[model samples]
Target: MATPTPTTDAPFGLDPSGRPLSDKSKVAAGLLGIFLGGLGIGRFYTGHTKIGVLQLVVSVVTLGLGGLWGFIDGIVRLAGSAPTDAQGRVLR
Candidate 1:
C-alpha cells in the first residue's frame, strides 16, 4: 500500500476553486471589540453577523454585560489568535 502525498498545486489557505479567501484585520477587529464590543462591531467586522447580532441582543438585555465578552475577545485577538472570518479566512 502506498501513502498519499500532500499536493502543492495551489497556495495555502485557498479553496479548491483556486480563489483566494478574503482576509480580516486582527488589529482592527481587536480595537472594534475592545471599544464597541457591546454593539458587536468586532464580530460584524469579522463577518460573524449571527454572533454579532446575538452579542448586541445580549448587551441590550444585560445592560452592557456583553461588553465584557467582547473585551475578552479583543484580548484574545490582540494576543495573536488570528481568528478567521465566516468564510474561514484567517485574519491578517
Candidate 2:
C-alpha cells in the first residue's frame, strides 16, 4: 500500500508551533471556510478529509449548495461553537 503523504499544513494532532492550537487559527479557518468553502479548502486545511470530500462532491453535484452549508459552518466555527477535529483540539 502507498503511504499517505504529509499535508502542507500542520499534522493532525499538532499545529505549526507544536501547540494544540490557538483561537487565531480557528478564526482563520472559519474565514477560509466562508470564502473558499466551495473548494473544501478549509476542511482540508483543518484535517477533515471525509467532510472535505463530501463537501467537494456535494458542491459539485448540487451546484454549490454544499458551499452554502460550509459558509454557515464557518460562521459557527468563528463563534467557537463548531466541533473540534479528530485530535480533539480546537482551532488555533
Candidate 3:
C-alpha cells in the first residue's frame, strides 16, 4: 500500500499533529504595541524577536520615533492586516 502525502493547504500556524504551533494572541499583541510599542513588546509577543529587537534599537536611536512604527503595526494587526507571525503562523 502507498502512503498518502500530506496536503500543503493546511492552515498557517497548525502543526502536523493538527494542533496550533503557537498560541500568540492578536489582541494582546495590539494592546502591547499601543501601550509598550517603544520597546517592541508586541513584536516579541508575536514571535518576531529579531524585529522586536530591531524596533527597540531603532526607537532608541530615533528618540522614540520607532514607537510610531509599532503603533502603526499594532493598528494594522488589530485591523487584521498583520495576522501572521515570522514563522508564518497565524495569530489567534
By TM-score, the candidates rank as 1, 3, 2
Q: Rate the local accuracy (lDDT) of all candidates.
A: 0.77, 0.70, 0.78
Model 2 segments more than 4 A misplaced: 1-24, 81-83
Error of 3 at 29 (Å): 0.8
Tens-place lDDT digits, model 3, residues 10-66: 333454434444467789888998888889999999889998998899999999987
Best by TM-score: 1
- Cα displacement (angstroms), candidate 1, residue 1, comes to 32
Q: How far is 84's C-alpha from truth in model 1 (Å)?
A: 0.5
Worst lDDT window (10 residues) for model 2? 15-24
Give candidate 1 regions above 4 Å deviation.
1-21
Name the lDDT of candidate 2.
0.70
- RMSD for all candidates, in order, please: 6.9, 9.5, 6.5
Choose 2 or 3, whichever is better by lDDT: 3
- What lDDT tens digits, residue by residue, belong to model 1 across residues 1-92? 35333345323345444343345778899999999988999999999999999889999999989789888888788886446778776676
Following a full C-alpha superposition, what root-mean-square deviation does model 3 have from the true structure?
6.5
Candidate 1 collision pairs: none
**TM-score: model 2 vs. ground truth:** 0.68
